[model samples]
Target: MPGKRPLNAAIIPSAKRERKAITLDIKLEVLRRFEVGEKLSQIAKALGLAVSTVATIRDNKEKIKASSQVTTPLRASRLTRHRSAVMENMERLLSVWLEDQSQRNVPMSVSAIQEKAKSLFDDLQRQQGESSQTEKFSASKGWFVRFKERHCLPHFKVNSTSPGSNADTYPDVLKSLIEEGEYTSRQVFNVDETGLYWKRMPEGMFISVEEKAEPGFKSSKDRLMLLLGGNAAGDFKLKPLLVYRSEDPEALKGYSKPNLPVIWRSNKKAWATRAIFHEWFTYFFCPAVEKYCAQNNLTNKALLILDSAPCHPVNLSDLSDNVRVEYLQDSTADSMQPMGQGVASIFKAHYLRRIFEHILEATDGEDKATIREFWRNYDIVDAVDNIAVAWEELKPATMNSVWKKIWPECVHFQSFSQTDNIAWLQRNIMALAKNVAFEEVVEADVGRLLQSHEEDLSNEELMQLERERAVGEGENEDAPPALRQLTTEALSVAFSHFEAGLQILTSNSPDEEWKFKVSRAINDAINCYRELYNEKKRRSKQLS
Candidate 1:
């Protein structure tokens, strides 16, 4: 017999209430925070989730992260669902391609993405030797709709802005803020990243040089990204941040990353990511600025100006109380961003000039083996040293002059003529190129090489980059080598060399004042090492 129903049974709710579904995006965010040492309760409160749910997500983090590898992490907001292996492979490759394009600031269209998907699927099928009976991928509009929602293409903005539209208005707005805040030139800084084919020469130059020497020589397309920044005053330049394809390249073995001339970081593509930028801001940028402010007797407050790059996180302002971050107008980067307004160009010219200088120096005696070794051993380490030298070559006035377009008031009046002249640099570079036996290289070739860094990757190049990334899979990024302790013996030997060199110079010199000045400079430079040597001696004695 059926049980008698209650009078209000129709209006009564079921005993078990439906639980709210937590999207994959939220779970991923929770995992990121957890990995970064955030407390479970804090993450729960921040995301408006229960502590239990946060804990559950943390427990299942490995699964969640593995699932995200199949698609874009941020775009996978929906619940996890099973996907075929072929589709996963295609989408994963497609995501990497999309990210690469975004990093280069290349715009994407729906048709283009659809076409790329189909092509990637075809490539995957050929590689796997799949049977024709395998399910076909249409890459139709419906699939794209789902893909777009899943990956968050264009990162929620179809386009940033019409090119150069905000050039005039943005400056005025920034000027008003600068005035209101009473920010000095020293308080404002600008940063931007650019691609560098670190080991490669001008387009065909490398191929020609390499082919003549060795049949096995291959043109190196290896690239790295550099982040350069400086205060408007130009008195303070931040150490460049270098992102490379491999964190631990063979040439850089046994080097302490912290002591590197640049802030070193890496990923498979060598493109700067949000996490990398955030890490830089927190650890390197803030501490350096604080120390600079203290030494210069300026207020600790600072204003960091950035372009609308996809790598920069929106929460940059929340990272530091003393440092304020502002973004320049979108699409107007070419016209209004201080770094793009001649600064980056000048830096690139300096870097190129250094490369040419190295080649000439290496081939001065025309030693074939030396030149071959130079070409072979020229790796990230060499590139890094050259980058440091080139950066040092930038005059303060040149740095200040770059602000003239974006904020004229911030620019100091000075003779910035010589170092900032792009044409002069090009002439010097051309001279060096000819000296290095690149007789056909011209000023126009140098110009084109600089422009190539900003150009979009071609289809073939993109495929090659994807293949390189695939080859790097399953390998963890190696941590930088630990700082090696200075030994008393090494310190003493280094000092002996310095003293000997100074004595030799002093003896050879005829001018008394010049000798005295050189000796004084050498002594001053080695003073820090002298102290370290003494400290090491004291420690040895105590241990004994």
Candidate 2:
């Protein structure tokens, strides 16, 4: 009654407002700013978001970063809690098919794309055996629009009316981009995948009939995928991205994964999957490029060139602000991808040579019996070591020269051609194979062995791979066997030996300073064991 005397004194109620949504791009920027010591309140103010919202975004940085890789319509501001795996996989594969169709110049319509989407979704459902309960997907106009947005595809002919109508103009496109961006050889990179049958020997090594008759005797078909890439400059070779069928192979039980030369990952079929590729891009590739830029005093911005592989996510550019991803024209990869331009062939040559070297080292002039024994015991760890050594053997000049076909300006040396290098490696491999008692192994056989990796898997092989895929989906992985623990008595004896060795070194030393340094280093090295020994002693005392 008192306030009613004046309209200005009347209390008014405010309406509740809907929450604002943050896009992946904005979130990434916020994180970047926060990382560089920007205040949360300031970031919030700059981005027109609440301080609490900025803080929340910071707290969920990891999930947000991961979502950046797999999410669709990456620029969309709406917050999507989850997307089905089937849908994600379907879209990725569908994108690949669309690209393939485009490459072939096959005419495509809206209806055709919808039909293809439906077919792909159905195929995925059947593969997962969830068709019965799964909701029907119509692949309607809304979905098509979203899909296009997600893959950054424009409204245009997804296909052509005639074959070869769309000429391989990727070379010109890349040249234009290079010039426009003013990028040097070091700023441009290419990546590609190849198959590695780690345990496979050339078929020239004849298998006994009994061995052939044994179950699962197809060792040559036991394969893993390796993703190899380096900058056009060839001075920077990214660590090999190796994918195997098993997460923790028996052969690698005691190995520390982080310390391995290759970035190891796993897929049920040992094929390159989108998830693995995403991991490689975000964790390995980006960090590697960043490190390279910092060391070379170059700009952080980079251009990563890739083929239209199914494993590669289309929205990779959204993941990093400084990196731009460009795909080669479909079917032009073999002709234009720097990795395909003798880089992979050269790598295979190196790997094969390393394998033969391993045999030589193990059998010492390749005694057949010793070689056979070594081959039988050879495991994934051995393959990884060989791969590491082989990768290390690739010289920068060789890497730089491989780009001659794609970016000739990057090439500084032409003294050694890929053909010459490969022939030399093959000749060495052939000679080594003969020493290993496989005199029938020819250069052609080695070439075939390399090409065999590209062949399609047989029906039986696909079935086996599918079973593994199922196991992985079900998360029924077998645990690696635990190592035998050292007994207290063994530990005590080891410590005694270590102390005795230190005392012997002290007594035998001529220089006091050198002796002290040596003794201190040895003691420091054994400190971990010393702690373990003390722990065991304490436990024994407690038991008494």
Best candidate, lDDT-wise? 1
Clash-forming residue pairs, model 1: none
lDDT of 1 by residue, 70-169 (tens): 8765555443434455566677678777877676555567787889899888877776675633868989999998887756665622454554477778
TM-score of every candidate relative to the true structure: 0.65, 0.58
RMSD (CA, angstroms), candidate 1: 11.2
- Tens digit per residue, CA lDDT, model 2, 256-367: 9979989888765566767778878876788788778888999887899987766788999998887899987654565667777777777777888888888778878533
> Against the true structure, what is every candidate's RMSD?
11.2, 16.3
- Candidate lDDT scores, in order, read 0.76, 0.74
Residue 37 error, candidate 1, Å: 34
Clashing pairs in 2: none
RMSD of 2: 16.3
**What is candidate 2's TM-score against the reference?**
0.58
lDDT of 2 at 37: 51
